[model samples]
Target chain A: MSDKSTLFKFDNISVTVEGKQVVNSVSLNIKRGEVHAIMGPNGSGKSSLSNALMGHPAYNITNGQAALDGVDILGMAADERSRAGLFLAFQYPLAIPGVTVANFMRTALQAHRGKDADMADFRKLFKKKMADLSIDPTFATRYLNDGFSGGEKKRIEILQLSVLDPKMAILDETDSGLDIDALKEVSKGINEYRNNNNAVLMVTHYQRLLNYVKPDFVHVMMDGRLVTSGGPELALKLEDQGYEWVEKEFGQKAEA
Target chain B: MNIVTDSKYMIPHQSPALERGPAWLREKRRASQTEFNELPLPRRGLHLWRYTDPSGFMAIPDSADETAPSENYKLVEKLELDHLKSGNLEALVTDFGGRDIKVSRSGDDVTKGLVISSLSEAANSHAELIEKHLYSLIGGSSGKFEAMNSALWNDGIFIYVPDNVEVKKPLHLLREAGVEGSIQYPRLLVVVGKNASLTIVDEYGGGSSDFRNGQSYSNAVVEIIAEQDSRLRYISLQRQASGMQSYLTHRAQAQAGASILTIPLVFGAAISKQNFGVLLDGKGADSKMYGLLFGTSRQHLDNHTLHHHRAGMTTSDIDFKVVLRDKAMSAYTGLIRIEEDAKTCEAYQENRNLLLSDSTRAQTVPELEILNEDVSCSHGATAGPIDPMQIFQLQSRGIHEADAVRMIVSGYVQSSLKLVPEDLRERISEFVAHRLEDI
Candidate 1:
């Protein structure tokens, strides 16, 4: 287990879905001021891990514990987890019709501040943030994620990240369906949130994202377990050799 | 036959047609009074009144005192009648008893060949047209209130658009109900001649804010006869006091190649029932009926609609939406009937209700009766509260509890409002916003 003072720590966390274990005995640590990438194949429990840490009701944490800044998060509700400075950029954002982005953003900003955000200042800040991402001003008047294109939806998720400014963000497959240009824009948005004092956990199946947003640590996940943890070199190695080499090594470890 | 013996006031005695109307119309009202006296009141077992109680009808006071006009009632805007002919249509704004009913007209170009006047004045002038179309659509009978309206309606609007002419701007009529235990029987007879087009708006609102002792009943009947190739757009705005009860019966018949669209918005009333019927009597005719209702704080809104397709190759579409909150209840029963000989007819009915609170209630019954094998018809109904996942997503973004709900509800009702005309869309949106304020 990582030290309690660490920004985020997952100690032997196990989660179950429909009476079956999907994420088993996984331990991970996200230190303050560092970007860690978790790369895994499909159905390897990547999303389950993120959802469990965020306390999604469907992903029950059967055992172990997750904490933010030494405060336990296992029993907290999803909203409480968010209030505690944890955020998840979903792979597929839900559409909320009739809810304009401006109104939704303001309400969220107020919730994070535990008070109402002054309309004047909030407007100014929102425009600035929107400008930073090169988003059209009229987009703010549209319903949240309703009838939005795939890339546009991704941009909206990042837009929230820019406004809410949570301490640690889990980007769950944020690069799944983006082309090179959209990938570059999304990476730029994520990089804006990157600083020396805040951490980001980027969960993806490809190393293309790592190229744009460099990470200090890269971990390989297979069959719900972390098989390897290395520097940025690990991502390059996996790209060169494919996941077959890691699968073979896991088999040997189990035999031993 | 003295029909007034059962009630405090005699029906034929209070009818304006009995005194001032032509002898033929006077005799018609007398016969209608006899028929109303003979017909039994609707009982609880009738399917038409399943969700409605008969007590509201039986509790009518012996006589509605005539109210003198007061300055409290205001006309936001006056519609013009210059383009209409001198003696074809009548416009009357009636108060309870004392004050004279005000009538104002705007716009220029009054040289056209259409009659425009008050119903009371029309009774003396165009008595023949009034006698022909008045009470003709009711046929045998409807129910108690409808029969009563046919027997004793005093003030109303009579519009007749001549053939081959198109009215540019929509005609607006405002009826304001005031005082408690008062009964206002408002009637409208719209006649569109062959190849003519017209749009009319009927706006109803209460003059008083008090609901309890200020209880009032408005039994309004709107009958439209669209000749071949004619087009008519009719919109009704029903805004009553909170504790008042309102009953409305609207019927329209579309002839060959003619079209009719009716949009209704119901916002207020302790208990309200609206019966809408659209009959396609000519081949290739079409009808579109759209309605929206917002009920909150113990309001009960019941809407019944029927699309009777008696002509082949005719089409009809009906979409009704309701939003209920704070223990408000809503019931919707819609039917699309295709007659045996009405082959190749097409009909669609859809009803959707959004319940904002657990205490709120909604019941939807959409049915279709088709006897023609070559016809195409379908109906759908859905009732559910807000989606939890949707709420969670909005909450994750930091939206407040109330705003999130507003967003969900506004989205649910926006689709129905889109079918209304541009001039009335903003008014409907504002009305919905006011209904959602307390919740």
Candidate 2:
């Protein structure tokens, strides 16, 4: 590999939840700059794959390999994995009762850049990111996710994505609970972050968000396995033909 | 398994030092000494002592007199902010174990016929006024600690606001205690005159602006006389050293059309138990009591309040919240008593406690005795640990677990601390934040 080359790979990884396997042998690879969309129905293991990769306690990775640039991250804690350039925008972020969003953001960034993180710089950067994302400045003072609208939560998630920039980002179901307007705003934030050295893997139930942030590749996952892989045309095809054709033709074979 | 008989128990000796006050006060002290000697140490049989046994307090430390004033003579101003109008009636007394009693009052109210004097000097200057109200309401037949205070208390503070005169600025009392093995019986007697209003902020701690660091035993008696048609707010803050032990009694009698609000913040002391009671003595008298307690370390704190609605159409509302961490423990028992003739009264009581550690614990019991069916009364109590989900959410954002817990505790307590008047909120918040740091 060249010095400039960057890669995040999940080579034949399996995840189990409560002794029942959820994500079965899956292999995927993304270099420094690429976008991949995992489109699947409910209970297709798409969410499990992202959670297992991020070290969520509920999802246990039972087999095979998962790594960042050939360095195994399967053994790393969630925070360690994050510090090593892995980021997951949770589908349902917990509501922290007393912590303000500004403080939470500062502390998270500090964990990576040392505790004495430049406060003035953080304020300046935060001001610009919040403005760019069209978030009200007052929202920074609110407790994290406490009484926030579904749309507001997704917006904050994108705001976090922009500020806590990582080498590769896994956005799990970022479009699931958002309205059309919120989905557009979320896609706008994701669209602004694409580069050759930064990858994005989006797990979604529909292709609504795909229309805004175009993906380089689209993979169909069914019953814990990636049944078929193809280009952006596959997303358009599934959007139009409704995933039934893919389930009938390839889901069973992939399961076997 | 050794218990001292009444004949062998320690009491104030009849030395000249103890006989320096008014002859009546001196005689009262001599009599109360016998009473303290005759009474046994508080056992677990009393409902108020269920959470603790005072018999463990084996020996009352002989008063260790301060040989010299701390070179630092500057007033420890915890509430003297530029924003506070309270500096108008300022009083500073440190080295409390010393033999000096002088209240350095700003005296704007004194010029308006207000009287704030040293209780020791009351024997000469305002002997009649002090004799009329001092020790008349709270501790005559109270208990061992009350009798001890009545018998041994050497210094006194007397605050008397003249009739129909409203001293808009607060009267500040800085009660800082130091000197190891010293037993201090500090007394504060407040008599707000008819139709007059006054505010008193009483601060208790180790004289310097530091948290618990000294070892002392203090028994304090606070008697407040809310004269007819008067309004008063008594805010007491305890920031004593962890080595200090305090057993206190606070009683307020509200006369007709009078109102009183008592706010007590309990933060310090190794073992502290307060018996706070209020009497609505006349028609239309009102009492609003709110308290906050934050205990950490191995501290044991017990607080009990009694709301005696003695007259018709009188009202009382009591609310208290406590936050505990480490091995700290707190127990609160509150009661609302509406006598048969006290009809058409309203009463509400609630106690909420947040326990932050596995070993930290709290017990709250809210009780009511209503003799009139026309009275409206309600009471509730709850204790619980910090929400783990709240902790996980903060950790997921990369904050350390300890910081997260501190934030939650602060939020829980800050909401109740907000009930304090605006002028005192900043200082109260600073004190709370500083205490949270130790946890």
Candidate 3:
């Protein structure tokens, strides 16, 4: 099969965080130009799946094989994985105090484009991206995520998503803590970053974000496993019905 | 009982610099010489001497005299000269191991009543101001090393801004020590008059390159006075060469309605012990100190800061940050003391240390002494390795591990670096970056 058919795929991925398995042998494939949404209740391992895939130090992938463009990524370091065309938008983006957003982005871009990246070009691109996200120009100089509101932090995450421009982006709970207006702006950033050559896998608890950025596939996670998979309508059903029915049908009890 | 009777560390009775000054000045030097001879090396049990060994800074008996400035010192001298010619600085003073002192003014018509001359020259020209304020804050009785500097300094820098005169640009002092096995005493005395304002950058560089072959010793003393309603900003940048043992004592007093800002940036030297203190002597006086130190390799750095509120309604704040990597070690002790009569005063002190490697060691002690009932005082200290989560967040963005560490460290010092002047800030940033390059 052509690599384009499976831009990002993980098979039998089992993750144990701190010696307790959080994601159990979950398997999925996402093709280029597709957006896959993982909808689940809290503690259902949706975030863990994305974190393990991104090579978080605390998350141990016991038995899994992840690949981007047909290259194994399980053995790579977090930074190497990122350089190999994978990205993770953290649910709670850590605040790097005293580091300006412009400075952080410029350094990240340099890492991706090698040290020869023109700084003048970076400034221009950063200004345009900040404008595109409706972020105030002043934020370019503001410390990265420091003292930012919840919605502002989420917006900055998506800003990184667009600026880094990876082939496969795994966004963990990018829609949480954001008001409707902020949710709309974040979704707009995700949509803008999505194209025929890139794919997105968003782990979200709510179906509201999917309304703005339509997904080609939606998966239901229960007890650290993908219990069911379907099209966009599945997310709407899950939103309307909640995860109680999925738990009952899959015979997997949610942790108390 | 541990009196250091070594004559090598004692000042000679007929030192040329002491002979050139007035009789009163010569008497003060003689007294300092006696103090140095009688004072003992600080005991290891003492709080200030617990981490650093005082013997390392002792004068080497057969050390060489003044040598030509290193190539790096020459480069920095040219840079400061350029800054002077371009009007970025009010004046530039270069002192080579306290032997030769040169002063260059900006040439532009700047503020009036501004005096910049060698300390010996000022002892004769501006004797009234120099004699009255010099040694008032730091003197023979301050400490053993302080007394050594007081008696042995061959030449020093003296700056004075008269009442209501404001120097628009910074005055830069480039104090360079000698090469291997050399012992030099560098002194500075600054007085800012009532309602006047001045900024000074005192930078130290050039010294021995290895201790096994031979080591150099530098003992420096700085005393500052900010009169009523005046403003003073002093930045002390120490980037000496390896294999140098350096000791520095700096003290300043701010009068009523005056404010003093002190920034100490330390990066080089094999072993360094620096003490900085500010006394709020009058009511409504204010003082703020921001210090940053970055140590690498096997360097040892020990620093102390004091904010003393002696008058009612005075205020003070201190933020000292230290970053250590490799096998380097740093010990920071800060104290905020409010006197009994200093009622309704407010003081805050914080010392944060970032250890970049498991092998690096850091010690932080933040102390407060509030003798009044109607005051607010708080002190905090924290020493730990960088947050792995922050590093992971940066690394997940594709930055190499070393570059990520560098970026995080640069950010940690960004706040203090913001307080420095533009050119110096860039130079300090370069120093910090160089320290973290191999991380």
Candidate 4:
């Protein structure tokens, strides 16, 4: 509950979907002004953890507590959670036809801010953010995520993150579908938003993203549990030795 | 006194004042009355009435005087009618009293010899032209409503465009309904000379909504003749008051190298049936018919269209869209018939419906009868609900379920509105939005 250190605390959290436990009891703390990366193999519940944090209806919180700045977010609706400064960059962005990206973004911003922003000021700020992310101006008029390439869609997610400026952002595999060039651009955008007042949870299966964003803490999740937590060296170790070494070490520890 | 009643005698006779009309015209109206009396009322057995019931309209009184215009009404406003040019004719506004009908010209290009005026006025001013064209295009035995319209119509519009003149702006006509039980018989006769061009937008909106048992009947007839190398764009927008019954009949004939475009938007009326017929009488003529209707509550809208290609090398395309919400119902039947000698013709027809609720119903039938070889023709119909995945996508972004549905419906209808002019697009969008609010 102390604001002097941790920005978000997930205590003894367990989530279930369709009677199958996906994210088991796990406790983690993300400190203010730091980047934390959760790296693991596929089906390690990384995405489930992110979705549960964002209050997605599909990911049921069986027995756990997720709080933002000491306020319980377990009972908040998705929009309410969003208004409370929670953001999620989905692994697959949905396509909404007939709704321009610019219009949708502005409406989201207004809804989150709880007031109508001046049109002139909003446009200027939006244009600046888009330029910083290297997004083309013509994208504003295009339909939301409609007919966008994989790389373009990823960049658009980053674009929204920059524009919304949420208190805490959960990027779910933003680097999964991106090429090298797109990954570099996305990393730059994410790094630019890293400040002393906000925190970020990057969920990925590889160490490529941590190489650029420079995570302050690296946690390895296996079978719905955070087996090891350490400094940046942990990410490099996992990338070099793969998940087999972690699985063996855990097996040995269990036997002992 | 037995107090006996007969449907035939229930209708009032056209005053002897029209006795001055040419003998040929008088005989035509009399013969039309006979046809109106003999033709059977549309029944549920008919394919055209599959999704709608006509029993409610059968009880309407045949007496036109019972719903005659009252003297208390005044011309609300005079719409700008100057957009019509010579050779290209537009619509006419007739007051309920059968006394005044205003006709305006939109453009200044008058070519050859053209005449545009009120029907009653034309009967007195240009009797020769009226005698030659009026009722000639509208067959006396077409249907019962056509016959009734011919016998009861008091004042209407008459347009004659000379050869080779093109009118730019669309001519607009406004028909105002006065008190309850107000019967309006609007007759329009348009004649396009050889090599002429014109565009007409006939709009009917303005009347009190408190007329529950008004038994209003709008028997309208439109006759168009397109000469060689001529083009005509005719648009009819009918938004009648609730609980009103409307029977409209429109017919057009296109000559060689002529093109005709007709678009109709029907929004109101308790039970309404519109019959539109386009005849390609000349080779190489083209016709396009487009329609959109929105029915809510217990309203019933029946639309029947016929595209007759009587000449060789003619083409026609028809597209109709309907949206039904609540307990409302809509029926659309389109027919494309090609004559034996109409070789190398092309025809296409499509009808699509969107049902917004479980109670709403829509019936669509697209028929094609081709008797000529080396011709291409196709017809299709579709009816269903909105896509659910699209809805979830919008909901995931924080938009409410209801607003998401509205956006989808708006987008579905916008496909047709894209063909309309830019100035009219926003107006139509607002109108559609307002209609959805009631749903």
Most DockQ-accurate candidate: 3
Taking every candidate in turn, the Cα RMSD to the unseen true structure, in Å, is: 5.8, 5.5, 2.6, 5.9
Model 3 Cα lDDT, one tens digit per residue, B1-439: 0112243465566666556578888888888888987898888997788999787666743345656778889999999999988889999999999878999887765678899999989989988988998889988899888887787778899999999998989999999988876778899999999999999999999988776666777889999999999999999999999878889999999999999999999998999999999999999999999999988889999999989999999999888999988899999888888999899999988899999889999988877788989998888888998898898899999998888888999999999989799989998888887777777
lDDT of 2 by residue, A1-256 (tens): 3524657888788999999989889999887778899999889999999988877777889997888977899888666777787888888887765567887788778877767766668998988899988899998998878899878988898888898888788999999789988888888899887777789999998998899989988999998999999999999998999988988887664433
Model 3: per-residue lDDT, tens digit, A1-256?
A: 3435879989999999999989999999899999999999899999989988988888999997889999999989899999999999999998898899998998898898878766667778888899999999999999999999989999999999889899999999998999999998999999999888999999999999999999999999988999999999999999899988998899466467
Task: Provide chain B TM-scores across all predictions.
Answer: 0.88, 0.88, 0.96, 0.86
Quality of candidate 1 docking, DockQ: 0.38
- Each candidate's DockQ: 0.38, 0.27, 0.84, 0.22
In model 3 chain B, the worst 10-residue window by lDDT is B1-10
Q: How does residue B32 of candidate 1 score in lDDT? A: 67
Which is superior by DockQ, 3 or 4? 3
Error of 1 at B314 (Å): 2.8
Candidate 3 ranges beyond 4 A from true positions: A1-4, A117-120, A254-256, B1-20, B60-64
Model 3 global lDDT (CA atoms, 0 to 1): 0.88
Q: Give the local distance difference test score of model 4.
A: 0.74
Model 1: residue B43 alpha-carbon error in angstroms: 5.0
**lDDT (Cα, tens digit) per residue for candidate 1, span A1-63:** 432236888889888998878877888888887889999778878888887787666778888
lDDT of each: 0.76, 0.78, 0.88, 0.74
lDDT string for model 4 (A1-256, tens) is 4444877888989988888888889888887888898988898888888888777767888998988877888888666677677788888887776567887777667665555545556788889998998999999988778899999999998888888887788899999988999999999999998888889989999999988999989888888888888989999998899999988876223242
TM-score of chain A of 3: 0.96
Cα error, candidate 1, residue A89 (Å)? 2.6
